[model samples]
Target: MKTQTLNVGLVGYGMAGRTFHAPLIQAAPGLELTTVVSRDAERVRADLPDVEVLSRAPALFARPDIDLVVIATPNDTHFPLAKAALGAGKHVVVDKPFSITLSEARLLKSLADEGERLLSVFHNRRWDSDFLTLEALLQAGTLGRVVALESRFDRFRPEVTDRWREHHRPGGGIWYDLGPHLLDQARALFGMPKAILLELATSREGAEVDDDFLALLEYEGLRVTLQASSLVAAPTPRFAVHGTRGSYVKYGLDPQEAWLKAGRTPAPGWGEDPLPGCLTLRDGGEPELVSREHAGLPGDYPVYYAGIAEALLHGTPPPVSVDEALEVMTLLEAGLDSYRQGRWMKLKESNGLRKRLHAH
Candidate 1:
């Protein structure tokens, strides 16, 4: 197989840029980490000594050698940076929450279409081990028809930090931060929800943004709850699913992020599934406990870059398509509405504005 080398220009050297994008882009086989856009030239050089660190976003976009631009900047800059990259005739990959509003996402999608560029959103949680296992079990009917699913991403950060997350601003809350992961996973498992009931609040003392939230997704013969919190010290079941035939419970997080942070890439036991989730099912006389191990697939962040390369070079569809991301954004906006209205909000109705404006 023939492969082409793709020069990548990464914007922003923040936590997301340094920790996630840089490492993954360097690890990808068909991609080259050529240039980075960051004001902190010293830090960028220290971390990525070989790659040239450009000071401004436009400088990187102007480079003829760069084939792809990865945007890991703050929520507000996503739309503008992505638009500029696409307009510069470069492929773009924006981090989660795609943009602050559904309209911004729609606009970027339209702009990408007009410019004939490949655009993708980085919803890395879709590759999470526990999520992958649950998806497989559900697909194989091992859990028989899933009746209810509950997912939780809890933490213990009581005091508001110096980061932008603790502030009360657009895309400055737990919902916009962690909600994308849970909601994206839910939408992946069960399409769009008919209605969403949200209970969002600042449970932590002196916290401006919402530190906790619980969103209930209503589906046919299925009830899904997506939750997150910065106040819960002791987290509960990571994933719990109940089905007609049986139930599966897993109590651990995926190890990819931890391993990556630890600087242990390509090592043995990477992205390994922890263990078989305890299961309860009816065999013949009564319910029995079954311990079945789920197969572990390698967590490859490089796949995102590979998809971008394929899309830009060969005109193939991206890994996370714009339509799929738009669906997630719609649910996110609906969740916000549910939080404010103090009731369930239908996604279709709440997102009608964007849909009508971006109608085919």
Candidate 2:
């Protein structure tokens, strides 16, 4: 008998779905792009004419054909949607920042456990070309010991849009929006930081939310600076890592976002690095900047969905496990606390609940 394919149900048709999840879902094999729940049925149908577009999530959840549900809704609705999907015995994929708080993340984990459903998050930035290159460099130890690492995600949106992001509300700021990506990438490279120093502000006039954030992470001898701003005109170094032996500097954003926004999915040279990174070294007395092409990795966002399918079908672990997401939430809460209290927050003791999850 032929094995059954995983049927997917996407809960939103906004930028997250239109740009990231939908195209990737259709690209991956062993998965069926089944249904999408959107209020504007005409818009959703226009994009995915072949797929079934529903008006509400209940319609999608009620269908036995859907084996997995991907939640790409607002930051506030993540928990409720994930919980309801898991409760209905459907594996789920949540977008980044998982939920508004660490408690909600834990609650969803419990619900998934009780319902025996697989839960994962779409931390797709992990597969960026430059990040993959940096990961390889660090693992190879060509830089000896990494001393300081800097990662920045900046834009020149000085004027705040009418979107919910510019409004001062829960999970409506640069820290919550872009913080997860930076923090998760850091956790992937350098475990959790011992502590973090945050510099957060709202630069855009009449903006009710924070549009700028800079976090300094401290590890015994290694220090990492993560910065994101919405009002920068000049682009700074995308990535800069300094070590005892050499330094690597990469300038340019990954091409995945651009390609995805253009309705292009993962194909040959999909997430290729556009700009050649520079490698500088001081051997004897002089320093040299060596131009090198980073071997780009495929941006496999569909892998997260595929992993969820496999986990539910065979009782395996999801790609972005609940524990890993909790770690990120823990870091986020700590960063916010540090920002609010104006003092360094030790990540180790900040979220006891999250630490327990980490222990497992």
Candidate 3:
């Protein structure tokens, strides 16, 4: 097959845009980071020297040569920017949380369908080393029939900055920021949960929005707990999974984000995680630590853009499908509702109109 190069227009220059999207998109086989829509021309030029920097998103959308528009802007701006991009007949990839609301995500999906453009979410954590390892263990039945899973994205940021993420807005919160990754990973591992119970708190002294959250996703015979906090000095197991046969406990996060922050390009050993997860087996109703050096599967963020390129050029499926992202959005909204009502929110009927709308 002839490789087709797709021109990508990135719509932000913030931490996410500069750190994750730009480098991954550039590293992808058939995608080119051609244009960036940011007010900081000097900063964009400094990182992406040959890329065109546009002051406005509309101008970038109007360009006939741009094949894909990746929205890495603030969470609230995701809906409008993606709507415009899809309307302009460009394939769109939005950063996590899909949108501020389920309605916005559904509308974007509708527009993408009408425009016949491929739409996907950047759930890059799906490719994380720890996650990949757990997924493999589950598939291999190493941990037979996982009954409980705990995932944490804890950090030690005691002070909340004045960024949009920390402001009291629709999309500003740790839940929206990190919840998508955790929720998506859970769903990927155990499919959709029957219900969700969420507890949110503004723990930091100066925090305007929620800086801590603990969500409980209930399955048939499984219980998944997802937690994130801005205050934590000690290390917590990134993933702790237990089942009938054994348990797998892992500490330390995947190294890709840190690597990207250090301005390192993806290459050999890019996603290799040095910290191995400890696996324990049940020995005649007694637990025995078998191996603490179980090698984690390598993480690969570049696979996301590479999948996008193949989807756009050769008719392959996207890395994260639109339907899967809509499911994540449903859980996000349910989490908020659960917190407000102080009860568990059921997801059985949540996919009503949106699922029908996407059926076509």
Cα lDDT, all candidates: 0.81, 0.82, 0.90
| Residue lDDT tens for model 3, 166-272 | 99888999999999999999888777888999999999998999999999988766778999999988999999998877789999999999999999999987899
Model 1: per-residue Cα lDDT over 262-330, one tens digit each: 766545555676554666667653767555544545455556766777776677788899999998899
The regions of model 2 sitting more than 4 angstroms off are: 283-302, 313-316, 349-360
Top candidate on TM-score is 3
Write down the lDDT that model 3 would get: 0.90
List ranges where model 1 is wrong by over 4 Å: 1-3, 284-298, 349-360
**Residue 72 of model 3: what lDDT?**
98
- Consecutive 10-residue window with the lowest summed lDDT within model 3: 351-360
Estimate the lDDT of model 2. 0.82
Tens digits of per-residue lDDT for model 2, 257-324: 88788777677666666686777766554665454545445444556666665666666777788888
Tell me the TM-score of each prediction against the true structure: 0.92, 0.92, 0.95
- Model 1 worst lDDT window (10 residues): 351-360
